[model samples]
Target: MALAYFNGNIVDMDDPVIPIEERGHQFGDGVYEVIRFYQGKPFMMREHLERLYTSAKAIRLEIGKQQNELETLMLELAAKSGLENADLYMQATRGVAPRNHLFPKCPASISITVKPSRELPQDVRKQGVQVVLLPDERWQNCYIKSLNLLPNILAKQEAFEQGCFEAVLVRDGFIMEGSSTNMFIVKDGKVQTTPLSNYILAGITRLAVKRIAEELQVPFVEKPFTPEELLQADEVFLTSTTSEVLAVTSADGRQIGSGCPGPVTRKLYEHFQLKVK
Candidate 1:
């Protein structure tokens, strides 16, 4: 069985009992980060933690543990789990309390679970995948990685039922992002994606991809593009902590460009591999 760290205690996943009264359970009052590791070294761990703390602060939730302490504990959990290639899912929730809809005096409750990493399907990487357009029905504070994910969950379910890789969310006719990943499109050899705003999560992989684009001398732009623009783009893709860089060959069953992973997407994917290696 995998190992889990709950409130500073490491235990088997099957036995890490969480109390029913935890505020996160009742009200989704929490923030989380998922750290991916390669060859036992976490990739961009500091960036992920920084975002996690930022999310917590935005929600007015106090993460009592210092950054150093959290880092040491995460490394220890990784070592104890003996997972060379894994994903560390960490979450901090407001403490247990009666259902009051208000902050309580209880300390924050932290949990971390270690699981083996699952690579994106090779077929999708090589041939690219299809996505569906969905309405962006999330809250205004998506920039904060809070645990209120009902909207995201519903969108993901819609995508799964449609046999698509992701749901590209649209708001006010402009493409915002995916349910679980960030979206990018290439038009006339220029790369464009939604800018960093409350509309989308500022993804770490998105930053890494931008750097790779710069290193490769690929033209990069960050601005809002409509759903029609996205559909007509020469190429499209999504990025996330787990998915890394993925090409979208089609949306709503319509082919994109030549119906394959475009040159810019391939180039970024290659450079991303080199970066992580």
Candidate 2:
């Protein structure tokens, strides 16, 4: 039996009931954060919370709670879950409202749920995983971690049907990011990724990878790279809260470099693991 925080009350995970007219359900009007815990301690928690607030602000959706209060509630829920490794998922929506395109005047409703953590398959880390390229058809505010994600869902499903682990999204021929992760490329011993922009989500793991690269003396450059360049790179990888650092061995049936997780990716993953610990 796990615990959940809903509308300022702690309740059984399976007991809390969300109203049918909740705006998050009726209109996808919300922002969310997924924080990972290692050894029962949250990693980059401040960063995640900051991003959560940023997303909420971007949507003009108030979280209705102070940052400290939210953090305390999340940690309490994590302790109640009793999972050494788990994910803290919190979402703030515009509250229950009648269906309308206009913004609601009600205060936001917040919910926090804790669940078991997910680790990338050992085979993926050992042999790398395949990805396919898809056109970026999402809305302009990709930076917001809003509940609206139809395009991302469709693209990820398409990639799954094509036997790929993830979908590398392209905008005007340049690779922006993965469906649920940030894309990276290594060429000529230099690592490159898209810069922080409205085109993609600024993933927390992506920031950690950059910091690890800096500490390890890896040349980490932030710039846009085309889909052609991504396919031709010596190595490719993706980063996300759940995926961590994942190597992309092939794209669209084409082998990248030696068709394996290259040395650079391996080194980054190693350092990232140590950082999390």
Best by TM-score: 1
Write the residue-wise lDDT of candidate 2 on 55-134 in tens digits.
99999988888999888888888988899899888999999888888998888999888888988779879999999999
Task: Provide the TM-score for each candidate, comma-separated.
Answer: 0.98, 0.97
Off by over 4 Å in 1: none
- Count the clashes in each prediction: 0, 0
What's model 1's overall lDDT? 0.92
Residue range with the least summed lDDT across 10 consecutive positions in model 2: 1-10
Q: Quote model 1's TM-score.
A: 0.98
Would you list the clashing residue pairs of candidate 1?
none
Candidate 2 stretches with Cα past 4 Å from truth are: none
